[model samples]
Structures are given as C-alpha cells and as structure tokens.
Target: MREWMFKSRQKLLTAALLLVSAAFAAAQDGAAGIEEANTKVRSYFEPGTNLMYAIGAVLGLVGAVKVFQKWNGGDSDTGKVAAAWFGSCIFLVVVATVLQSFFGV
Candidate 1:
C-alpha cells in the first residue's frame, strides 16, 4: 500500500511537470505566431498605412472631444454614444491597418 501511494504521488508530480512544460511551450508558440503575424501585417501596409493611421487618429480625436463634452455635463447619453463611436472608429482603424498591411492596399 505504501509503495502504491508513493507511485501515485510520483505519477502526479510527473504529470504536473509535463502539464506545466506543455503550457509554457504553447505560450511561446503563441507569442511567436503573434510576432510573425505582426511582421506580415506591417509589411502589407507599407505605403497606405500612414493614411489609414491618420484617419483613425482623426476619428479617435473627434470621439474624445465628444466624451469630453459629456464629462463637462453637456449630455450624459452623449458621453456613452461618443465612447461607442470611438470604439468603432478604433476597430475600423485596426481593420484598415490589417488590410493595408496584408493586402498591400
């Protein structure tokens, strides 16, 4: 019985170590994939990326202004609306950047 218990503990420890190592390896792989994807995306946006970024900045600025107005007590609902618009603008910017980088447009 004692031997069986020892064996069980050893198995559990080994399994735990294996799980930890696998998790670490997976995380590293994911990080590498992300880096590779970013490189690819950046390469795609070579020329038009700047323009898309500019547009995104403009939209973000407008949304920030709207949010500021709400903070100043201009309108409660307006603040929320502005925030949503800001988020949408940011999404658009990301999409544009990705497309420009990947599709070269």
Candidate 2:
C-alpha cells in the first residue's frame, strides 16, 4: 500500500511538471505575439510623426494670424495671446519628437 501511494505521488508530480512546462511554452509564444504587436505599433509612428509636424505648422500659421490681428487692434493682451499660441506650437512639436524617441521609432 505504501509503494502504491508513493507511485501515485510520483505520477502526480510528473503530471504537474508537464503542465508547468506546457504553460511556459505557451507563454513564450504569447511573448512572440506581443513582439509582433509592438512592431505594428511602431510602424504607425512614422506617419504620426509627419502628421504631428503638419499640425504644428498649421497651428503656427493660425497663431501668427491671430497674434497679428490682436496687435493691429491694439489689444493689451496681444503679447500674452502670442505667447500662448507659440507655447502650444512648441509643445506639439516636442511631443511628436518625444513620442517617436520613446517608441524607438
């Protein structure tokens, strides 16, 4: 009876080990899939970079016009408005660059 119990425990241990190894193999496959997804995401960064720059340029043009209008109108807050617009344009440009770098694109 003791021998039988020992054999049963050994079988259970072997089965658990097999299940653990299978899980590990599955995890490796999942990791590979994740790598593929990462690559796909990185691929989008190129177009996004261009789009960001374009948006910044447009914002800069619009901001310039608005600031010019304010200055022409003799508004006291022209400087503040110009500063805010310039800051936004700069932020857009910097964000694009940072995102590209962060994604290793």
Candidate 3:
C-alpha cells in the first residue's frame, strides 16, 4: 500500500511537471503571436494615417459647405459651429500624425 501511494504521488508530480512545461512552451508562442500582431499593425499604420487624412479632408469639405450655408442664412452661431467642425477635423489628422510619430511605426 505504501509503494502504491508513492507511485501515485510520483505520477501526479510527473503530470504536473509536464503541464508546467507545456505551459511554458505555449507562453513562447504567445510572444511570437504578439510580435506578429505588432508587425501587422505597423504595416497598416501609414495607410491608416492616410485614411485619416482623407477622412479629415472629406469632413472639412462638408463642414465648409455647412458653414457656408449658415453664413448665407446669417446665423449668429455660424462662427462657433464652423470652429467646432474645423477643430474636429484638425484633431483627427493631428491624432493620427502624432501617434505615428510617437510610435515610430
């Protein structure tokens, strides 16, 4: 009975060791996965920035049209509205550019 208990304990220990080893191996794969993700994100970054710029351009044009209409209508809040739209467009472009510059990606 004692020998059987010892054998069982050894088997339990062996299984635990194997599980730990497998976990470590899997952790290495996670690092590789992260690296791959980083590379993919960086590859998209420049084009993403360009897309942001394009979106900003489109928004600016739309904002201009809206502001133009407001100005023609003699709306008192036209300046405020125009400023809000212009600020938003600038923010989008600046954020994208700053992120690229900060990350160096």
Identify the leading candidate in terms of lDDT. 3
Candidate 1 residue runs with Cα over 4 Å from true position: 1-45
- Arrange candidates, best lDDT first: 3, 2, 1
Residue 27's lDDT in candidate 2:
100
lDDT tens digits, residues 23-102, model 1?
99999999999999988866666555677778788888888887887778767598568869788887878887677657
Candidate 2 lDDT over 1-105, as tens digits, reads 999999999999999999999999999999999999989888888998999999999999999999999999999999999999999999999999998888778
Residue 94 of model 3 has an lDDT of: 95
**Per-residue CA lDDT of candidate 3, range 1-105, in tens?**
999999999999999999999999999999999999999999999999999999999999999999999999999999999999999999999999899999997
RMSD of 1: 11.3
Lowest summed lDDT across 10 adjacent residues in model 3 is found at 96-105
- Against the hidden true structure, what lDDT does model 1 obtain? 0.81
lDDT of each: 0.81, 0.95, 0.97
Q: What lDDT is obtained when candidate 2 is compared to the true structure?
A: 0.95
**Best-performing candidate as measured by TM-score:** 3
